[model samples]
Target chain A: MEKTNIRTNKNFNKVSDIIESLTINTNPDSVAVLEEIGTNSSIDEVRELTSRALVKRNEHDSLQVVISNRGKGINDMSTIVAMSTINELLSLENKEEAMRVLENTISSEGFDEEVKENARSVKALMALS
Target chain B: MSAIEKVNQLSHRIFNTSKNEQSTSRTSNPFAASNFQKNILTEDVFESSKSKEANKVNFTGNLSASSKRIYSVFVGSINDIGSRISSGIESIKAFGSRMKEGIVNTCVNTWNKIHEIGNKEESLNGTKELLGRDITTFFVNKREREISKMANMNPHMEVKSIFKDALQALEADMVQVA
Candidate 1:
């Protein structure tokens, strides 16, 4: 598990570098360039870049979808990520469904013990309602 | 009872008895040996050099007190803006209703005045007095239409100003955060 974490970290760092390079080289203001990059890049590369950038932006965002997904040192990083996730979820009309997704994500075994415990407390409080 | 259940009950009773004794002891002499040990362990741990170093490291991380203050400020400002915008909308709605009522009242008063004048005198010197009433009514209608149009556009203008202010506030906040 530790080895896999190190590997993921390295991969994320590499992808981050690639994204920074892309951002520097490409015109961010131009939707055409973004669309072109999306179309031209290999499916795996695009997915990896998008996923890693999102993770870099907020690790808990990816975790909210899959409960058991573990990243050791990402708890502090989760707040901004969680806020962004909540913001996105709020944008959708089906807010209750979005909240359910958030709940399920946090409940998953992939989350750290503290996060899981917090989620459990929240669930308990919600159940009281 | 089963052996384990009997043992559990006995242990629980013993624990409860000891806890009661400890509480009684605390009231008499709070700085007793057990209390001293508990205080030393909890308090001294926080005051220790190792704990201080750990805290220093934690403080440098994203969830530091300063970062938390910034996040709190952000959330607070957003909430304030949301509230102000909503209240502004409500105020505009209230203004619209009041304006509508005012226009209706004016129209009703003008009609009453015209009816009273027409009843009082059947004819004027040369031209019909109803023509003057019609011209006044036309001007009132035009003015009401203009007021309605302005009222309809006012919300959009206010919305634009609110958005502009919000963007400015956000930019200033970002600069502060940076």
Candidate 2:
């Protein structure tokens, strides 16, 4: 068991370094690339970390990717990753942009009911905390 | 002449020896006995030195006034040594009390530290403010905030370069994992 942990630690550290690099990229297109790779990534941990990175960006474009994209961010089938993204949204220093995106997702008829519901819940949490 | 007479004679010799010690030395007197002969002459071997020092009358069977003065001086020296030993015992008792004081002070300090550790009011305050986030989340958030600041400061930075940098980072990760 200890040996397995040691082997996985190296891979975990490698992922962390790459994730840090993703957050370091400053261009607007990085958000789209992040949404594409983050939402579609097979690994739940990657999706979770990437979703958080997007929310931390706090830009309208980055906020929309995590808040409205299908099967990504708040819409992730993985409850754990979706919750992680919600927690990040709630924790943002400036909630104005994220709240606007959520209001759009909730009011617009284009989003799935599930995604809108997640947005409403996140909004409620933001109001509470 | 007899056993008792010999003892009396020896004491008489010692008494006169002390009285006229300036002029009549024991070694110079032809009749005075050696320490070895004194031992042989005494009934018990251990009796020689101590019993020899014990006061005996002069040839007249009465102690001289000068002899009493010498005995008093010897008793005074013994009393002085005994008092010094008693003072040493008193000092040891003082040291024991000082040691006890040091132990009490250490116990008090440890008790104060324990109370400081048990204080929970600050933790409760932090919980109310949501300042008690997990350490891993705190570090990740701080890193993302840095990225946000960089993006805001360098508006001219290209989206193409950002993708290129991210692709390079992923490729490096794949190589390492492999």
Candidate 3:
């Protein structure tokens, strides 16, 4: 029975390793593993861990910008990049620079009233600093 | 009927039967429904307590009324400081560049004067020293304070309490789940 338990544990470890590798290489497989793990683990635990991971990733990106831009003697360039990157991260609803880019794209063409109203709402929902 | 629709109908009947059985069991045991209701009430109480705690920390009412006012003033102040610092740096650079030009001009004038006196080498050395000092001063003080202030403002701790409270709430949620 102990040997059987050992075997089962090894199988579980193998599955977990496969899942981890899949998370980097295959989007659908990663989602499947995430779902499986989410069902097996506590749902809130998964969400909290994911949230922390996202925050850490954002911090890492910000730090990378600072480190790379240091000693360049170009303050304005560094300041603008840092501010824009932070604003992008802190802007919750827009997800990416999509809303800003979309607004610019739409406005370059003459504004239709309907499109303008939609853009306005989107901007409000996804306001950046 | 489609296969999916037929399967759904069958599932619905099964669900109804299970629900009926549950209701019959509840009717038979008076304590069961009361216990279930008690659990529901407890859950609602917990949720309300959590919400109240969140609201207290958030300063929700004060925030709604005065946040915009405070932020606009804060931003305006920062902008004013920033512009002043930028202008000051620019002015300093201009002044330094001008001073360097002035020194060179003065050297040229002195060189002409000393050449008349047959002392050209002495005047040339003096001009070099003057230009070097001016350039050093120019580069040394370029927006130093402004850059320091900007760096200080990064990773602001103003909303740290809110983040702490959020983390605390998450921990509490994890504990409850466990």
Candidate 4:
């Protein structure tokens, strides 16, 4: 188990380096790397970056689907990431599902108080809009 | 029975009762009476050191790794934008008064876009407005100084315009992920 942990850490580090390099180079390949990390990596920051990068690259539709699918079980930090990603969705009609996810996160005990609070606030903003 | 007989019987019972064959076992401390003790007298064997790998704690879980990577990339991207802005300003500085009007127009337009995208109420009541103002002021002052250094009296309008331009560029260049 310990060895597995060590190996996993190494893999994360390697992937992280690759992603950073792609981003730094502004290579189109970075989008694929980001997408992979966003979907597969358990890390929220990595996912956030992937989502943001995807949005910037005009991959909004796919990003929305990804967020809808994987944006569950959000804790406080993941809530922030999820909210930020959701905000970038661009399409108001499509945002309802993502917003619902945030609403669920607000009620979820796994998230920290701040995340829940932010989720609540984002939900409120949605209600107002 | 008579008292004297009772007394005699009690004495006999007390004195002649058979002792239990099983005796209570005695225990000894191993440290106190070990037969094969080491001759060397040092506390090094008892002293402990933490492993390096153990000390290097891995931030495992969702928030830990994700937040860290996101933060790093975010900061890096910001720096990249800042450098780009600084370089633009430097080039404008070289162009002197000729670029002043263009710079201000650009900054003001950028500010308007930022205001539009961000909630108007928040832009007015929030830090964004203050930040936008400060940024505008900074570029205005910077451009004014550079123009003065060239011994050129750039019109006040031109200075304001250029400052606005720079501020707009700054806002546009800043990745609005949220």
Looking at model 2, the pairs that clash are none
Worst 10 residues of 3 chain B by lDDT: B154-163
lDDT of 3 by residue, B51-130 (tens): 67878786436565578688878989999999999999999999998999999999999988878676657667778888
User: Candidate 3 has what TM-score?
Assistant: 0.17
Per-residue lDDT tens digits for candidate 2, residues B1-178, read 7999999999988765643343334333433333454342222223344445563433423556677567667668778877887788778878987887798789878987776665566557677556546666797687667545544543235433443455446545545655
Predicted model with the maximum DockQ = 2
Best first by lDDT, ranked: 2, 4, 1, 3
Alpha carbon lDDT at B29, candidate 1: 37
Full ranking by TM-score: 2, 4, 1, 3
Candidate achieving higher TM-score, 3 or 4: 4
Deviation from native of the Cα of residue B91 in model 2, angstroms: 27
Give the DockQ (2 decimals) of all models.
0.00, 0.05, 0.00, 0.01
lDDT per residue for candidate 4 within B50-162, as digits (tens), equals 43354457444345767878988998999999999999998887687557768877998998888787777775677876888899999767655543442232323233233
**lDDT score, candidate 3, position B103:** 100
Model 4 bad stretches (over 4 Å): A1-32, A72-77, A90-129, B1-178
Candidate 3 C-alpha RMSD relative to the actual structure: 57.6
Tens digits of lDDT, candidate 2, A19-101: 54556666666677667655566556667877888888889998898899788888889898888899898888899999899
How does each model score on TM-score? 0.18, 0.43, 0.17, 0.22
lDDT of 4 at B82: 99
Give me the runs in candidate 3 sitting further than 4 Å from their true place: A1-129, B1-62, B81-89, B92-100, B107-178
